[model samples]
Target: MPPVQTVATIRRITPVGAYHHLVLDAPGVTGVRPGHFGALAIGGRDASTLLRRAFSIHRADPGTGTLEFVFAEAGRGTRALAAHRPGDTVDLIAPLGTPFPLPDGPVGAVLVAGGYGSAPMFALAEEILGRGGRVAFVLGAATEDRLFGVERAEALAEHVYVVTDDGSAGRRGRVTDVLPEAVTVTGATEVHSCGPMGMLKAVTEIATAAGAASHTAVEEAMACGIGICMSCVLPVTGPDGVTHFLRSCTSGPVFDGTSVRWDDAGTLPDDLEGAAAMTPKASHR
Candidate 1:
């Protein structure tokens, strides 16, 4: 189903370390799945920050008609959003983008997250477990405070590994450092991750090396949240063995890790589809 734009009232905002957990009464929005995101209008209807900020949906409770997402005060838009009080209404277009694909049958899977990227994994883990699958979590961040959802992950996953760069948490290293062990211990056949591009790339490589398929929710800038704006295009190789710039907001947010052109992220590759046409032909000498 297509997404709906609704004026969702702020239920409450809870401070979670360096992030804010926002809950909204959005009855109009439904069928939210893990990896889906919501685009919220910041400030007010006529505020200067015209662009809607995209946030991955943390949890959606259709029974309560409430939706949850987490964010940090990174800039003007997020700062304004952080200032919203309970009962205030914010325009939201939600349940957007492709969601993480669940395994058809019961299977062991490893979930990896970095920083607030842990927001979406709990729900995904729950669904995975509901299907009789086993889940192991490897959560990492720069510090302990930046890590989110440790308690919830522990409650749901069979094993939860926490790591921080400053040694403020379980281990002082990246998630990749503990990922192989997590997969090995859980006997996970699939690896799912959401985090910074570099982290996702590393996780994908590690998962592949461990003989597990990887699914990644890329953290790309989505200026519009919708596909209209070409801002969040990334090079992705399709099944036909052709590289095309796919929109993260539409074609994905979740994609097979092996399909992404991780090495050529920031720039268009010369071999990308239409690249030859876009490049200027050698001038007649």
Candidate 2:
């Protein structure tokens, strides 16, 4: 579905350590899929900042016309968002991009997330459970405070495993360290992951090796969430086995793990169709 551009009212804003969990009353917005994101207009139309910050839909309840986003105050735009109060009006273009595909039959699934990337997994877990599939979670962060949605994961998932770099949480290692055990114990048949590209890559490899299909949500920097700017292009493989650069905002923020060219994620590959044009022609003959 095309995005809905409208003014939304801030219903609540709660601080979660380095990040803030925000809920908006978006009347006309609906059909938000599990992996969809929103492009939020920050500082209003008069502000100096021109680009709208994009965030994954942490949760969206179509029945109530409410959408939630979790974000860290990383810069001016986000800091402006952090300053919002209840009843504040903000512009939003939402329910954008492709969504995660549901499995055809009931299957055990392991949901993995890193840092604030955990934003979208709770809803995904709920979808899985609603489909009669069991869901397990493995969340990791640099430290305890950076972890988001721990309590929700524990309550919603069949089982929850956490890992923190500083050893402040469940296990003192990377998600990769515990992924094998999580899959084994839960009898997971599929994996869904989101977070840093490095973490996604690791999960993809592990899941594939374990004979499970993997789907992942990418966190690329998108200047325009509507795909007008070609800023968030990433290399992805097509069904014909051709490598093509596609926009994450439109083609995907979510894709099959094995379809992405992991090694060339942030950079264009040497043999890419238009890669040569990136280099200027020689001035002298």
Candidate 3:
């Protein structure tokens, strides 16, 4: 289904670092999953950049035809989006990418995020909570200011652990330092994550060591939000050990960490909370 501007009204606009959430109306985003995303053509080709900037759906409210995004004011494209007004027309490409897989039975699930990576994890938390599956979240930030949306995540998880390099918040170290103990205490059997390469690696390592299933949501500098452009390819190691770059735009923003090679993290990232949030962790499956 094509995306349309139902109302395109800003619900809340706050400075998350430099970016803001337009939290507007987008129809046909109900099917969007936790790891999925959408592309916005807010200002059109008037600026030096022609194409649209991609943001993970922070949320998609089917009842209201509303969608939310956590975006950073990185460059020209996003700046254009920030300038958009209420009832403005912003084209959206939504329900893109597959959602994180749901673990069968009562599996302990852990979510780890760094910076804005918390976007998708929030949605995953809601899924786990809805299923009566317990979840533990580990969020890392360089400093207190780098963190956004911890309270939002707390609403979904059993416990929320914050680790800041500056020691202003919960733990005074990397998010990994809080993982082993938290997972053990929470009895986590599966892990979901979205963040920097290092944090993703740490989560993968912890899950591997703990014998838990691990999935990751990765970001790439994208030209096209859809899979048409092979630019956001992620290198993967197949069963035969053949290496190939998979398109993140189409193949997935969410993939088994074991399946995809955690190539160096992207220089730029995408907005994800609602997209990460929509990841279809079923209600009564």
Best by lDDT: 1
Model 2 error, position 116 (Å): 1.4
Tens digit of lDDT per residue, candidate 1, span 188-265? 899999999999999999999989999999999889998999999999999999999999999889999999999899
Error of 3 at 156 (Å): 2.8
Model 3 over residues 198-246: C-alpha lDDT tens digits?
Answer: 6777788888898888898876777887778777877665677655567
Better of 1 and 2 by TM-score: 1
Q: Which stretches of candidate 3 lie above 4 Å from their native place? A: 1-12, 17-19, 263-285
What lDDT score goes with residue 44 in model 3? Answer: 49
> What is the C-alpha local distance difference test score of candidate 2?
0.91
TM-scores for every predicted model = 0.97, 0.96, 0.85
Quantify all predictions' global Cα lDDT against the true fold: 0.94, 0.91, 0.74
TM-score of 1: 0.97
- The lDDT-based order of candidates, best leading, equals 1, 2, 3
Please report, as a residue range, the 10-residue window in candidate 1 with the lowest summed lDDT: 41-50
Each model's RMSD to truth, in Å? 1.2, 1.4, 10.5
lDDT of 2 by residue, 1-285 (tens): 668999999999999966899999997998887999999998877899889899999999878889999999889989999998999999999989988888766789999999999899999888888888998899999999899999999999768999999999888999999999888987998999999998999999999999998899999999989989999999998888878899999988999999999889888787776778886788996
